[model samples]
Target chain A: MDFQTILILAQDAITNSAIYALLALALILVFGVTRVIFVAQGEFVSYGALTLASLQTGVMPGTVWLLLILAFIAACMETARLLVSGARHKLPGALATILAPPLAIAALVKICTPLHLHLGWQLILTMLIVIPLGPLIYRVAFRPLADATVLVLLIAAVAVHFVLVGLGLLFFGAEGVRTPPFSDAQFTFANLNVSGQSLCVYATTIVFVAIMAWFFNKTLYGKALRAVAFNRNGARLVGITPHLAGTFSFALASAIGCLSGLLIGPITTLYYDSGFLIGLKGFVGAIVGGMASYPIAAAGALMVGFSESFSSFWLSGYKDVVVFTMIIPVLLWRSLTTAHYEEEE
Target chain B: MKQFLASISMLAVLAAGTAAQADITIGVNLSSTGPAASLGIAEKNAISFGPSVIAGQKVHYVIYDDATDTTTAVQNVKRLVSENKVDVLIGPTTSPTSAAVIEAVAASKTPMIQLSPGPATISATDEKRKWIFSAPANTTIYGTAMINHMVKKGVKTVSVIAVDDAYGEVSTAAYKTLSEPKGIKTLTIEKYKRTDTSATAQVLHAMQGNPDAIFIASSGTPAALPHVALIERGYKGKIYQSGGAANAEFLRVGGKALEGSFMLAPPVVVGEQLPDGYPTKAEALKFIKAYEAKFGPRSMFASLAWDALKIVEAAVPKALKKGKPGSEKFRVALRDAIEGTKGLKGAGSVFSMSATDHSGVNQLGMSLMKVENGKWKLEDHAEFK
Candidate 1:
């Protein structure tokens, strides 16, 4: 490859990797802390997009910033209510608790018609609503199932997926809901042409990811959540209630997914079914990083993103067949290497 | 002895005359679900319209649902012929299933009148295959006519995005043949399956090439509007929608986004003056008025079905009178009536089908329309010169 071409492709890969990284990392976060594989995580991404689009447009007008804040607040509140209610009379720890967040969102959306939302507003609303989703789902569904086997929680995740899809179709008709375009402005750097909205997406993902990393490393609650992810029972023994920290982890993870949703709308049009593909792609990213490590997961996402961009550039027609085919072999190699790593440890 | 012999002779003549009538059965396989439900529904309704059109004919109808699958289509054709004993068969809406049905019906030596975009399986070259017929323009005709229009508009560079099935592949092939020599350069070409929702990446690839025009080949709702996002991205390039998006529903969903967008399709009534004393035009307006009154004013497919029904109606009576029910003579008469039709007016267009061409509307009358006032309004009618 030419040096300039390589450089440009690398930049494009980095951008692609970052978007995938955010979604993958968020998915892993919910799983790592709550031990519940939340399948509805993808739906939250779509919900975030639709929400933001609705709020920013005069279709459901308020100040952009205000709408974002309100959407975020509403997301967290909804999560809390769902988790609390789902756990009310159930067995203290069951898989059902881990799925409550998605269930709640589905119910909420099912009850209300999708607002005719603009693309920008959709981005904002979806992002705002996603911040608290992970925790809410974890608190209700996974917390009760925290002590349950991984397979059991996996089954619960599948259930969450069904509910999310069913509700998405039931509420938003099984067709594309178009969002109007953002303003047109382009910035060229070197050989790459970047649009104004795309730059915002890149910047937002970075800022959000950085702030999250900082919060995890520095804050008391974030530290508690990390501790729980490290050793759940141990954290409980040390005076941290795993239940609350688990919820927080889920919320934070879901918020990241929401961020991915908001960022995607301007660059790509979205529909209810669009979430499943991205979600599956994120899963690939998470598995590439070994699924247990955030930094590594992000690295894997970057690698996948770069490879995709590279394939698209060099072998455009076979991009899909090339990218998807790589997944099986990469996964096998990763698993084999991780086994070796564990043996060494 | 003489009287007895005369009576015996009279009884034998009467018995032989009574044995001459043979019953003919026609099988119709159509979709009841999936994206083409409305089209299938109208066509199925047209089956009923057949009896009404021929007020005195009693032809047996055998209808089955293909359910929009190829395997099911093949199965249904066999069922209709072997079990239902149909002498003739029609339909299976889309190209893929239509192709399967055509092959099966041809193999069984049963005459079939398929409703499809003739490109998927049976081609004009394959017309010698005998016992097969199409009631729509082959992809070659559509692609050639559409290319001719583009060439007329001075569009020399074109980009194509379409579903990656027989219809898209064939249409693209035709476009390349007709446009390349005319100095039309195809910059970006992409294909997606009918089920794909994410056209962003593919469309983005197409936009990168920066062609003067884009041709979206897929007629399904999913493929229709993703280009709108490309338009939003500040691309002012002309978009030539295929014959598929010419439907009113597609326009309604695309709304203001589709304003001034052009299409290549058969003519539909959009504020055109009716010819005096044309029965089809009056019937179409009445049906439209009734449908709008009952179904909230967006009844576009109703008229097309009504026309198809009228075709069946006009054929049935003449066929019934020409031969007894189920007779070869009766079936042949029906075919002649359908094929010989000319200048028969309907709600959408004045239609005529000939033995050489099953498509009622011709390249001579392709309807060109533009999105105006949030609805599809006919801009002009073009005849191949």
Candidate 2:
């Protein structure tokens, strides 16, 4: 309970929360524009984690930065391909594009094991394929279903969750893959000692928040995106393709998910189940953040993270109780407030 | 055509009765896939191996996948009992699922060999429950063994990191009670989610307390490498783990870190080199060679399953003396035969059983092994209390 211990633990919590925030924001972005939810976002996160894990294990000889750069480039190319292919048609184009990454990741995993690549590198390669592939999925899967009922779209989202979950188990197996330990750099101010890893994760999340805020505010595309969110028909009448904006939102969300995967990857050692747990927490954060408010969502994620850490300090045996208890009240309050807003509007 | 059809119906009825008489049905109600597939596979293989080892009886197994869930276990057990009319039930691996099936199996008056660990609520205690017999070695044995060792070693303080489940909780509590009287103080005990693997922070916190050792009670592969991780951070102290880490997978996962580290195992099941001309050792060696040839390489989990099945094989002759194999009388007879066995030789070692002693095997037969080149080699053997 000394200050140094407190600081280090707090730093770890913040870093974790920041990563959760990035993921929640990405999820929010998809929901905001597409009026759809994708549960398979965790697969993309796993991809990033596995990528790093694969690289570190000497399975891949590439440097960390090189791996990151190559992955991003590959992602960009895949996104472009998805956008162009799904541009004109609706049925087959969308289906093909949406299903490609998962299929590719599965193939890569089967090959990588015999190749003697590090588990970390294999994970990274998978991430590289998955996160970039998310945008294409939105372009293909969400756009065609745009005119469908919310219930149908929700069902599709649930389907996506199952598909990803099934694929994850099929490829990765059910066990949690062990991650090799890495060194942590320390940052201290009097009684606080924050590890370098936590700091990096937090900083990355903040950077994404600022960049995304700028994207939505300063750019012409951002304005159009906002207009689509505000009123799709009005935006369409004004010559903006609301559907295209929806695709862009998904792409942005996918990239953020990649970052989230990398940051939180070490905390749980990359596993298929990480998606469901992290996704649930991210959704909780989104709800607390007003569902539509990016800043509020970020704040809510951080709050949840802090409460989880703080409660662990006191309620050692029932830390989970502390976390969910706090979330329930906040969620209830948010729901009541949102109801009032709807009535007022 | 009508006369021919009547003749065929009479022939089919006679064939069905003869077929029923020819085979003794054994139902396997364990998971075949999912998270606990390894354990399920072990249980299934063991049960299958039992029939092969049996001298003269033709045992047909009806396998059902429990999917590692309690509700599924109940449904499968009922199906096996009512529909298949299996003579005896062998499994429902892991604690929770086995507990769920206990009520059904006991109510039906069906004899069962509960092949699971403890902390799962048994529908009835030892006195009340006579029909159901656990092959034994519950959490109490593991906890008591570790506590006894720690006390003898003059260990004064420790920290525990256990999986947040009934098995882990029971062992942790038992350890705490045993540790206190011996003046072994616990610094900070942490419970981790079964799926969680990140223990560095927990380890660091435990280290901060500067306790004498750290007791890891997780059954996951993630917990296996903590010895290496702890060593990496420059902490030099004794490390004690639950029976979960006694398997070969831990050695493989931890590699050099596991060398010189101690594990509590259930006797030396597999031979320590080739033993001198004993038929049991020879048969075990043959099994090892055949298994290696077929499966490439298997962990200790596979070996344990192999031995468990051998026990079943030894009991079949006396149990099946009755004319009808599926009769309740046959099952009870089988259970009694299994309990009465003593100094039974197998691949693992000599194991004995009695009605009161269910685990049939305990740690006294347990020899301490160390990881050498990622393979476990015997280091020390001690008698049990």
Candidate 3:
């Protein structure tokens, strides 16, 4: 109600909004290109945070093993399809492509984890362990169903979410972990106190937001993905493989998720299942943008964060209820403003 | 062939009769792989060290993971009672899981020893609750200890930020009930979900009163969220934590922010720091030595499991005399015997349950602890009514 309280809440909102904004961008990107609403996107967040925590403690992270498992499964799926198609000559190369990265990463993790390297190395290692699951998942679960209906893909995404959550619990244990902050500096602005970490989060989100805009508007790969999102079959006819676009988009989404996790891990405690609610919030933001526009999605996520912070003050127990309900009006408006057309599907 | 078949049938019948009489099956349901997995893992590790032979009968533990879900807990309890034919049930590690299976335990006439940290886990007013006994120190006792500490520190007004669950409901109510009589006013009450990542709004709202202290009534590591938020907001007042948030993970997460906070925990938390002649000193030391040696570090949550065994060790022999291990009479007798537990000191607390008081742990079982240099140190303490 007062200025100071408002200031504090705004600061909290901005810090939280940065995380949600990052996630919202990823959700939009993945949904646009992959045609799969990646429900398991948030698992990458927890995996990234917990993997870093594990490596920092000089322990072998469970993600290394998970990556290997995903790699092996993907290899089996690819190899079987090639052999059934009588492409025996492509089988060995296909196997190496699918299997080699995870195997090499697992070896690197085994060697570097015990060395108790600096924070930068630990972070890079965490990303290395977690990022491959994006494409591997696409290969193993989504690729087999790539041409399936959206409903089928959505169902598969949910199933993958559960599997990842279960594996998260098994790999990371149930207790939540908070990493040591990257910087402990405190900033006293004109009327507010912001930590260095919050500033870091804000800077990182801005940089990524800029990067995302550039990637979508300026890059060739991004244009290919845009064409695929526009029309999958038409894009394929024009020499843009829908599957390649899907895999690339998934990789980008995974990297974004990993970055969001790394950013938020020091700010709050994160459990194996914590990513669901946060990711769900991001999905809400994506819906506000009609799940298509990146800039709008980021803006919507900030709105969600600010509204959540404010409502938690008034109706703290109903914070989630209030935030989730905001989507209804936006949805009604989206339906009213947008034209309904015949589906390409 | 006919003679051989008849002899085999006779041998099987005899072996079954002897095995049933010689071993008492105990069913344990804990959330080993879900939200409450931290508590369950600790309890499981400690319970595995329970006495395998009790009162000349082999003790068989049929353990199952309920995954911290109410439905899974009900299913596990039903299967344990119907199929395993357990004489007594030992767990359902969290309050939600424990509360969900009360009817199943009562219907099957199985005695249940609950290892949760809420007084609301079992209500004496409920008829079915007679079959269930609580093992951990009641959260109200923890609230009392915290309030007493506040009084000593001359705190007048307090705010509470609790989890929006039964644990929080019971805890905040207890704080109000205890604090009001001491002339300390309750300024604001706020609640947040355990998975909530931000408590900035709640902290600001709670700070509106500018109370002398703020009590966090949350379970496990989640308590650290609100606590850290308050500290980062530059609030100068004292911060207090409930015994439910006594785990080392809470300390680890809260880190430097928790340096001066107070927590009411069982004596087992600072067992080595416990003064001589404390009620749970001997048992706490024994537990710390053995548990830390094997498990590397001790989770005070493990004491809930350890205390359950202490109750069984003290009560089972008396119940065994009433009937055979697998019979309905033995279970009823075991329930009655545990309810009649008096002055039995265990790893975490002193247990004394009665028909009307399922959790009879008093102030003596709890110690006021302060976090100094990342470890719990027992304070020079006084008692409260």
Candidate 4:
């Protein structure tokens, strides 16, 4: 009720919204281009947070091993495909593609983690280790079933989520881990003080959003992605590779998820399973946006964050109910207003 | 030749029966790999230190992982009773799982020692709790210790925020029962689910009451959310946490935000820091040393398990005088012997059980601890006034 209290609540809402916005953006991007719900989007978040935590302790994270394994598997699949197609010359290139990045990343991690490198480099290393897992997952799980029904792809995504969660537990253990804040400074504005971490969240979110917007509107690759999202068959007819678009979308989404995890890690202790609930919140945001418009999805995510913050004040026990219930009216309105169309077989 | 073969078979049967009677089986069902795995793993480690022989009888342990699910715990208790035919049952770590196994233990009339820090509601009265006993101090002791500290500090009003689970509900109820009679007004009470990421709304609502203190009744890493939010909102009042949050993981996750927060924990948490004359200090230190030597650090749940085993060790000799180790009569004798425990100091607390009270430890065994510089420090005295 007081001015200061309201300001504090607003700050909390903004910090939470910033993270949710990134998740929503990632979800929408992957779903748009790939037509997959990407339920395992949150696993990348956990991976990112835990990877940083491991690096902070001056130990090489098991994530590097996971990356190597996934990359090797993806490479084998590609090699097998080339061999089956009788493309003998491309087999060596395929092998190189599968083997090089993971090995280089593993070597870099091995050298830097023991040195107790600065937090900035550790964060970058964490991101580098986690981001490629996205495309590798897509290649191994989703791409093979690309011609399958959307329902089948969604089930596969759920399966991936379970596998990643199990793997997360094996790597991180049952205990939750928290990292030190990026900046320990506090800024005072008369009656209010804001942590530097909150500022970082806001700044990073804004920058990433702007970068994504520019990329989607201006770049050739981005335009091609938009084309595939618009109509996959039509984009293929125009010589744009659908597979390339899917891989790019998945990679970008994974990066967004990792960044969100890094930003939120200092604020809360993260376990292997923490990402699913957080990602589900973003899914709620995506639904409010009708799963199509990026700006609207971001706005919806902020709404969710604010509603959760304020509702926890008004009805602490039912805040989750309140936040999740917001979707009901949106769903009802969309059902009544939007046209229903069935996809062609 | 046929008569000789029959005699040999009869001898084999008698020998097997004698071996089973001489070996006393203690079944341990714990949450070793689930949401409560951290606590369960600690309990498992402590129970490992139990004696291999008790009262001149071989003690054999049969351990099962319940994964913190109530259904699994119940199933494990059935298997331990019907299949293993164990003479005693040790655990199922968290309060809910412990509560779930009560019926199974009671049905089999098996003596069970639970290691959860909650009220022994599985059997409320002396007659009903004949087969059940708990190791940790009751939830009411935590409430009394906290409220006594509050009243000493001249705190007249407080607000409550707890997780909406069995542990949270019991602790909050106990706090309410103890605080209100002492003229401490509870301005508001709020609840959140266990896995919630933020408690901003709860903190804000609690702040509106403008109480002198705030008691958060959640446990583990999630317990840090409200404290972090409270500090961020600049609400500087006394913050109290329940015993469930008395683990090192809470501090590691909470960081500087939890500094100066008060909690009522068993003495084992601050064993090295306890006064020399403290009754539980020597025993607590011994267990801590042995545990840390093996597991890197001693946890509250581990201490509770160690204490439970101590109670068993103390009761076994008394029970043995009444009947043989494997008989139904021996199980009854063990239950009676445990109930008769008085002033027996163990790792976490001193036990003094009676027929009416299955949870024998009280506020005397609990110490007031405050988080200082991200570590628990024992307050020399509870008299803040």
Best by TM-score: 4
- Give the 10-residue window scoring lowest on summed lDDT in candidate 3 chain A: A173-182
- In order, how many clashes per candidate? 26, 22, 0, 2
Model 2 reproduces what portion of true contacts?
0.24
- Give DockQ per model, in order: 0.11, 0.28, 0.65, 0.52
Candidate 3 lDDT tens digits, B1-385 = 9999999999999998898776989898888877777788888888878898997888999999998999999999999999999988889888888889998999999988888755665766677887888887786788778887888889998889999997788888888888888999888899999888899899999998689999899978899999999988888999888877787778888899998888888878888887678778899889888888888788887888888888877888999899888899888888889888998988788788877888878777788888999988888444422
Better of 2 and 4 by DockQ: 4
Q: Rank the models by DockQ, top first.
A: 3, 4, 2, 1
- Residue A14, model 1, lDDT: 68
> Model 4, A1-345: lDDT tens per residue?
888778888888989888888999999888888899999998888889999999998878988989999988898899889989999998887788778988999999998988988889888999999998998899999999877888998999999999999899878877677788899999998777888998999999999999999999999988999998888888889999988899989999899999988998887778888899889899988888878888988999999999988888878878888999999998999899989886543
lDDT of 2 at B262: 57
True contacts kept of 4: 0.57
Encode model 4's per-residue lDDT on B173-287: one tens digit a residue. Answer: 8998899899999989998775566677788889886789999998776788788878877788999988778877788778888889898788888999987777888899999
Candidate 2 C-alpha lDDT tens digits along B1-385: 9999999998999988776765677777777677778777765654544553245557788889998888889999999989998877777777778778877887666666666656343323364355565554666666666777777777788978777787678878878877787778898887666543234446566777688778877675656544554664556777876767665545545656665565655443445443355434555565567566656554344555565566667777777675457777776777677777677665544557766665555554344455566666655444522
In model 4, state the lDDT of residue A56: 90
Q: Interface RMSD of the predictions, in order shown? A: 4.6, 3.2, 1.2, 1.9
Error of 3 at A74 (Å): 1.2
In candidate 2, position B377 carries an lDDT of: 64
What is candidate 2's CAPRI-style docking category based on DockQ? acceptable
Model 4 regions more than 4 Å off: B1-20, B124-129, B193-195, B380-385
**Under CAPRI classification, how is model 1 graded?**
incorrect
